[model samples]
Target: MSLRTLMLICALALPAWAHAAAPKPLYRDPVMDGAADVSIVFDKGRREWVMFYTNRRATQKDPDPADVAWVHATPIGMATSKDGLAWRYGGLAKFPAQCTGQTLWAPELYQEGGVYHMWLTVVPGVFHRWGEPGATARIVHLTSKDLKAWACGDTPDLGSDRVIDASVAKVGDRYRLWYKDERRGSRIVAVESPDLVHWRPLGDGPVVDMAAEGPKVFRFKDRWWMVADAWKGLIVLRSDDAKTWTLQESRLLEQPGRQPTDTAKGQHPDVVVNGGRAFLYYFVHQSNEPQAKADPYYGQRTVIQVAEIKEDGGVLSVDREAPVEQGLVAPK
Candidate 1:
């Protein structure tokens, strides 16, 4: 069947989504929701790719537990793809039973020194809570040699009220982190570490005027560039030192009329440069369902997509198949 035909059949077969949201079509296959933002990486040995994101609910069974309270319970989940097209859900990448199943939000996975490391915004309970204040929010992470045996690692303290949405990139021998620093009043900040274990702030922040959340950094065509999702669909910025950045573009890759709350919220993008293709992975909400009188974020799920960039500066953008409501795409 053709891709559109397959999608039509898939839509026909899909159940009436209960919440107030519908998932926007992002990547092909492995239905992408609006809550799970993805990061992609290539596996040379396996000849495939991997994507990591926040899981939220487990298998849609037992529900979110927070359904009673109407909040987002985001745990970490993963997905894998062979040709960057068809994907399969791997489910629950790594969770700490200690957090009591609370949530692992905004995770960024990167291969550092032949090892795969993932860091996420972690909370303290088995269920989800909102507006918990700063002191409780911390960045949780994991490190693995094989990507299969994902062992929980140290929790880095960036801020308390809102320590969330972390992005990692390797610049030379050192690996740098671009994350939201709540202490600085919700701005995109950069920090560097010789060892991924201990990180120190590089100084103030990369963006001072705007609420710079979900900062993703990568080098395209020899120049360092950054992507973030705030009020629009994937904002772009560039910096020579990872400190001072200039806005290149905002809402550049848009899927119009998707979400009521965020009409152009195709943000939280992470890019992986492989074979001259910089796959910029991002997520958004599809608001096409009946409005709920109760929870506003109820229909909110994650949809993963990619915008390709070439070494010679060619931009290629494509939306993949949607994931099962909040289902994640793991690594192959």
Candidate 2:
């Protein structure tokens, strides 16, 4: 082949190379610097990637050591990115106070028929500590035509009052929602919905029999996968049929990474599969670092990070040490 022709062919193939290096510590909440539980969706009208995350009040000055208020009374924060590398803070999401109350976490977003649907973890009121009397968590449904303003919908009966951290994906012709059931040993469970309104338990028991939270389910490599924060590291599970899941031997983001603001374990992930490649977006704390050890409050801060997910012989792996290639292509 002629040199010019060969070069032209190579140049044209560049778009097909789906993997690229993404920015380390991809995003942080500019307001409170406590971004977590990310849900990424492509805004078709705006033609950009939008991240909806929990905006914890980590910047509160000199919080009481015993007080857990910093984690409550949070708003769902938003950020936008054109290429999923450089992100711009977009502030908190707007929801009617009557329906959503003061605390929101783990914004799980799904789009169907041009409407955006969110299954958000809502706390009735702020509390100073965990497990305080009358503290309850429930998942509420909301719908939006544009990503900005949301209208409240029904809160599905998930058989638990302390349910939180929702992850939704369409399985076959039905939609499946998975979340943490804290009342049940903090295990992960599933519920199915036909029209995104009513829901019922997928089976008699939890999908993941381990103590985990922030379960995210996605399809990649022609198989269904679930990744959940197990407090130690993110656990991986695979399934040929989205309904029956088997645990993978290894976990992801369990070990610390050698990056600024990413020295701790990854938590509450959002996986985006684009252009035949899968990327895992997760949040990391600074608690294990030197600075955080000196100042305990520094550990409250968290940052979002992204890494490419690779599969070989049906095993999924991530190299946190390697620079992530930016491979987020716009969805059609």
Candidate 3:
């Protein structure tokens, strides 16, 4: 072939690469044998991405099956990443006296008025068993100027006793808190506050009809999006007024084929939107591969992971199989 023709063919073959390299999304926490229910936020003061999750005590054995062991009380886990793809364990998050030794579940984080706000699920006593008929839990709010030293002792119980997995967002002049109130159903409900302190119900009904938990809300593409954990997978909803929501046909992170450890479904996701792009963060159960005679890392473990989110025809989706390499753009 002529030199000019050869050059032309090569350029045409790799045209896309010339513009931008393909994304290779690779991020998973290996430090802890058990890490689940992940939330990621960019700290401007620290200039790093921080991930908070349930730092499960993997060594403590459960009388129940290992599959259900994540239910036990765990200190909130913390990890930081320079870029979105790779992460290092930072250690367990320190809570104030009120939260000390308290079993924590999903952590919802937000920053406003130069202060960091965290809404966490608190179980006062032993987490003998998950969904124990008489077990009670509540959502508490704590604020810190810096994430490290939290002013914790006070318990601002945001109403119902059986509520958990709080996801809050500031909308215009008020803050809206969405959580799963188990007493009503496993369905998610909403309460709004003008100052993030005193909260009142937005309506008398569940935001979602399905039995779901861990509802996370964020604004993207001039609209608000909410993704909730339904135990089966993630259910997506979109809202214009932030009060009334319409369910979308798509369910995200339901399959396990593309992930490194394709053993269990992705649960309790927190979506971070930065620089006009969205990313989904969640944790997967460690694989059930039998441990060999020599290998010790085998068996069940949970690790945090992230995947780039895509939007099509006003619907959002995440590809667990696609490689995501670029760091998430920090929110302005």
User: 48 in model 3: Cα distance from truth in Å?
Assistant: 1.0
Please report the candidate that would top lDDT against the real structure. Answer: 2
Candidate with the larger TM-score of 2 and 3: 2
How many clashing pairs does model 1 include? 37
Query: Distance (Å) between predicted and true CA of 248, model 2?
Result: 1.2
Residue pairs whose backbone atoms clash in candidate 3: 24-323, 24-324, 25-323, 25-324, 286-301
TM-score of 2: 0.92
Candidate with better lDDT, 2 vs 3? 2
Residue 287, model 1: Cα distance from true site in angstroms: 0.7
Model 3 lDDT tens row, 1-332: 99999989988886342434223223344554677777777787888888888877654445555344445567888878656665677888888755644678888889887888888888766645567767788887887887787876345555577888989898889989999988887789898889888878899899977899888999998999998887777889999989999998878877764534644577788888877788887767655333422343343466666677888887988877776656664455
Indicate the worst ten consecutive residues by lDDT in candidate 2.
15-24
lDDT per residue for candidate 2 within 1-332, as digits (tens), equals: 99999988888788542444566678888889899999999999999999999999987754477787888989999999877877899977999777788889899999989999999999988898877888889999999988998898998999989999999998878999999988999989998989888898898888877899999999999999999999888999999977788999899988898877789898989999988988889999878768876787888888899888999988889988787655577887
Give each model a TM-score.
Answer: 0.72, 0.92, 0.85
What are the clash counts of all predictions, listed in order? 37, 7, 5
lDDT of 1 at 210: 74
**lDDT agreement of model 1 with the native:** 0.60
